[model samples]
Target chain A: MIISAALLGVIAVILAWPFPLVLARSDWPARSPDVALVLWQTIALSGGMSMIGSLLLYGLVPFGNALPQSVIFLGDSLRSGTLPADTRFTHVLALGAAILLSTHLLLNLFATFVRAERQRRRHYTLIALLSDPLNGQPGMRVIDHPAPVAYCLPGAGHSATVLSKGLLRLLDADQVRAVIAHERAHLVQQHHLVLLAFKSWHSALPWFPIANRAENAVALLVEMIADDRARRDVDDRTLATAIALVGLGQQPEVLAAASDGESDEPWISSPERALVAPRVYRLMNQALPLSRLATMAVFVTAIALALAPAIVLLRA
Target chain B: MLRMANLGVLERLLMDVLWDSPTPLSANDLKDSLMRPGLATKPTKPLATTTVLTVLSRLETKGFVTRDRSVRPHTYTAVMTRATHTAELMHEVLGQVPDRQAALVRFIGGVTPQEADTLRQLLGVATTDNL
Candidate 1:
């Protein structure tokens, strides 16, 4: 029981702290976001499971012969309509804490999903009320907003890419196509669902640095993933310039990007300017393709990490 | 799968008719109004009443138009004033996810401060704090 508890503690600590710090600084995700995304998922899932599992195991430690025996005995005790009288106050508290934490995490996750889904439905309803179908463009809508904007609301059959009139007026034909390509990549790749998972994790472990880092990393990595997909058909320069033009055209207040070096905008406090600067930089100097061996290693590591909690629980 | 946004040209024309009308419009009334002279650009062919009904039903389902079933021909009225609906849609543009900076799929918008910093660091651009 002690061995399992210690292992769970170590695994939880690795996933919650050092792993995210290290992964956050690594440039590997830039080269291959999909693999890195998988790795982040492994850490998050396993980390959460181990945290709860370790607590439960600790709570059950004084009951039975071994870790599994204790768990079985604990289950039997609860099912038989009485908790063990031999349980200590600390043990009861630990068990109560375990149950509460697990429930809180699960409930928060569910609430996040419900909230996102509700917001999506409302957004779709609003879009239906105001947007007009773009002439000669199938599956695209033109909303008559002045500020430049383009985005896709993704649903299985209900997906629609929306471009504001300002956006169309601001960008030339190729730039418009590039922007559409980016939005299309999001729909094709189902990035929203990936984000939903990370978002739920962030909500569940609001104070954990790993949860925060995972949310940020997944958000940016998915953008890169979409950019990679967009660049396949669109020229890199065109895509980069399109991003710049849209970014610039939208924020009239941040006009200094024209004078200052492209990288300077990243230092600005405005969220939009900061996001655009790096994306522009990455497009200009694309990361080289990751080697097959490195890709395989990432996959292997992800699989092992993701399975760690399950393995520990099953072994007991 | 009828789209709520990107209303078809005919649908928009129907909406225009409903918006301008003081009273609820039946399908035949809508067709007559659309076919009238000097109403924006007309479709190549005259709109059939059945087409008008299809458009109205689609609009009704989308919550743009509410059907009045008490009358003989089943009159339809716009659920919301056009101006209010337009403003609401524009103000509530994108970012459907509940999480700030967590809506990874959105393009052409601002992210949260933390997301901005993380992205800046990843791209090797010196963030404000670093600068």
Candidate 2:
């Protein structure tokens, strides 16, 4: 009974925590659209998967004595006649329902991993092209492709950042440098690993709000970090020009390169213009304000606090 | 002159050698110069002329050093000053990140205090007087 209670409690918290976190954290500043999208996707996928898993597990607890301990417990209760036969039937039915739900959830997670792996491999080729020392300066190689595109691949020795030939022709040398610098920052920060973690979490528990929010926040923060690096190394005007130029072009199908897709309608429909405005504003606003820094500190602390209960429970 | 943003660490080292040298260096000359004398260095392999040619070609493409085909043995000359190239590379690196403050905070948090201090100095930030 104690074990069952503990397990149920743990599962309940896992299912419930992510949602509030996501809601609270969304309002905080983010780095880029790429990170935000990935985060939301991960959370949605993970929470949905877990919910399905739970339902499946509930459905599979009937028919034969498949679950040995549960059956034995039922049998002992039956011999004693302490509980009615109808009650036992109801208990078994409930268990079966849970099993069925859990199975579906686990299967969904498995499918997501397979899909992500496929996507990662496809993007890796572009990353390899960028990292290749053919021309030097571990920069991207923009292949001549018609549609605007960008993609990244994490490599063993060095990563690559591949861009489309169209993008290269679109911007001047200074802008191009800014773009390369941005990609390099991603590599240095190992942002891909963070995305991978959040993605897996999302797959495992598709209904969790916190998972979605955390993933989104991290993604945005990393992009912001990379952008900051670009600001310091390159002239703000040049970097802004690069962002404007790249953002103006249609986003490529490839996910490795940074792009502002054409159909990038902001999340809010009524104030849709704010999305494009923020991108432009961010580019124009080069100065780092103290208020922003304070806000970030508060945000980080909140995340840590939100994650604390789970950490404690796990440790206990 | 090669853009610092485009050069790899090894390529940079090789360029440094050529930049400091008074005369043009053949492939053999470069290989000999690269053989570190005092340190526990790896056994030097005889570098092929093709390898040197490839590196030179890459350097040329990045616009760091220019080739002077005027002589019988093609010679290379530095197009940009070393200081300018370093500055450019630094600029390129920083330009890639979207949020410099957040990235700096994360980066500094990840490193040792001493290393963080060094980075702060490198970035020309005002440092505290404490050790």
Say which candidate scores most in lDDT.
1
Task: Give the lowest summed-lDDT range of ten residues in model 2 chain A.
Answer: A265-274
lDDT agreement of model 2 with the native: 0.47
Reference-based TM-score, model 2: 0.44
Once superposed on the true structure, which residue ranges of model 1 sit more than 4 Å away at CA?
A: A65-68, A252-273, B1-13, B20-31, B35-84, B94-104, B111-131
Pairs of colliding residues, candidate 1: A128-B4, A128-B5, A132-B6, A133-B6
- Write candidate 1's Cα lDDT for A40-134 as tens digits: 88888888889888887778877764776887888888889787776788777877888998898889878877776676766665666568778
Question: Candidate 2: misplaced stretches above 4 Å?
Answer: A1-27, A31-114, A122-134, A146-148, A197-221, A251-277, A286-316, B1-131
Cα TM-score of candidate 1: 0.78
Error of 1 at A48 (Å): 0.8
The candidate that achieves the highest TM-score relative to the unseen native structure: 1
| Tens digit per residue, CA lDDT, model 2, A1-316 | 2233244345445545755465435533443334344434444444444343333333323322233454565567668876533444645555565666567555755665566555444334222322234255454454434323344444445356655565577777776677677777877767666656555565555685565555545555555666667777787656655554444343222212332232232211111112222333465554344365665665565454445433433332
